[model samples]
Target: MSAQVIAIDAMGGDFGPRSIVQASLACLSATPSLHLTLVGQPSLLEELLSGQSAADRARLTIMPASEVVTMDEKPAQALRGKPDSSMRVALELLRDGKAQACVSAGNTGALMALSRFVLKTLPGIDRPAMVAAIPTQKGYCQLLDLGANVDCSAEHLLQFAVMGSVAAQTLGIARPRVALLNIGTEDIKGNQQVKLAATLLQAARGIHYVGFVEGDGLYRGEADVVVCDGFVGNILLKSSEGLAAMIAARIEALFRKNLASRAVGALALPLMKRLQADLAPARHNGASFLGLQGIVVKSHGSAGVQGFQSAISRALIEIQENLPERLHGRLGDLLS
Candidate 1:
């Protein structure tokens, strides 16, 4: 396969270009077929790149961007005032075909707005949804509309199911079982919107809709893809992340309680590390903006080097599988 070129909004995240530069270099060393274009202040990026080996630097390019969209800025304001922002520049690169994918740990609203303006949506998609992988008992479950659309109709929910199912297939699931996120698993449960979505999903072709799944079913691996409106999905994602962090902190507190506990901790150190790795938010930091004509991966704004790298990896996988193209074809067939 040919090399995949990716553009990164180097100034987007909390750590600015420092973390992004380090992660980009690391990704280049790890993947021989990967090339990166870092978009940010040229001076800052150059300072960060200082002392890097020539060969490693060969695979990386810098595109100077004058402004940055702050995390708190409104999406409309940023779009109108900061055309030269790193986030916007990176998306422009994708639009121009200079990069196969773009990754950003920036303002979610601004990123989504800019991406929609620059890349547009696939033919049958009215809006692009945020889709992400959530760790589950069996392995992982794909969930969609994670804070993109605050209000969604039944048709929107059905669209999320279709897009999510296509994404699961790209991730190696042959026939993914799909489900609606509802209050109960019964045939007549949830709000009217969810109930209506269920009807559409059951009749939709090219998707394996298996009915409704509750919040608990998400972690139980009861279904491969869980569909919900952005309002509910965003709340669920934040709550899950917060719970994971609390559990990890409590575990550490327990181990540090006394000398006796410390000794016990030593014995269980390996198991604890494994659990931490699996539950760490950084490991699953990337979320894809599905239904866009081009691939865009949204890294958590506060992500560190490791987290940003995970986002890059997510983009690479989507690019390799030609996710957008596959989704377009599938939706076309289903609609036809």
Candidate 2:
């Protein structure tokens, strides 16, 4: 089999090129069949890559980009003003078929806008939704519209369900139990949009519509795929992350409260580390902009080396599974 090539926007995120370069080298070392093209200012990228072994360096290439899309930049302004930004350049590589997929920790709005403009949406998809894997009691659940489309119609919600189901299947879930996010599990709950979407989902050909799931039900693993509008999904994701961080912080504080606590902490350090690893946002940093013609994974803007590496790994998996192609085929039947 041929090597899989991925383009990375090295100039993006809070840590800039260093974290991205570090992750790239690590990924290349771990996956012998992986080739990476790091896109950013050539000088800075070269400086960061200076310490790598020649063999490791050989598996990577640098693509120069003069501009960068800042975290606060407006999506429209960034698209028009920064044509040569690292984010845009990376997407171009995918557009031109030079790379199988692209990964970026840039401005989410700008990334989505540039991706749609460059790669376009799939045939039956009117808009792309941000989908991610969220840790749940039974393992994880795939959730969608996580801040991509703030306002969506019933049709849009139905589309998100189809796309989310396909994504779950790609990740090894067969005939995923799909559900609509709402205030209650009752069929009579939710507003017009969600209720209408529920009806459409039940009538949809391929999916296994499992009715509604409340906010608390998400972590309980009530469904394998959960669909919601971007407005609700974003708040849910952020709130969950914030709650996890607070719990982790409180645990650390309790452990350091006194001598006895400190001793106990030392004894329980291994268990704590394992729990922390399982709950770290870094482990789930990547979110796919589903319905795009090509694969694009968005890392959190403040992600570090390990977080960004997780994003790159996500793109690689989607590329290998040919997610776009599968989504396209499944969408035809679902939308029909």
Query: How close is every model to the real structure, measured as TM-score?
Result: 0.95, 0.95
Q: In candidate 2, what are the lDDT values of residues 1-336, reduced to their tens digit?
A: 579999999898887888889889999999999999999999988888787789989889999999999989999998999989999999999999989999999899999999999999999899999998887889889888889899999999999999999999989998899999999988889999999999999899979999999988988999999999999998887777677667767777888887678877876676655555445443445889999999999988777888888999988899989999999999998898
lDDT of 1 at 258: 71
Could you tell me the lDDT of residue 139 within candidate 1? 93
lDDT scores for all predictions?
Answer: 0.89, 0.89
Q: Which residue window of length 10 is worst by lDDT in model 2?
A: 275-284
Q: Backbone clashes per model, in order?
A: 0, 0
In candidate 1, position 103 carries an lDDT of 98
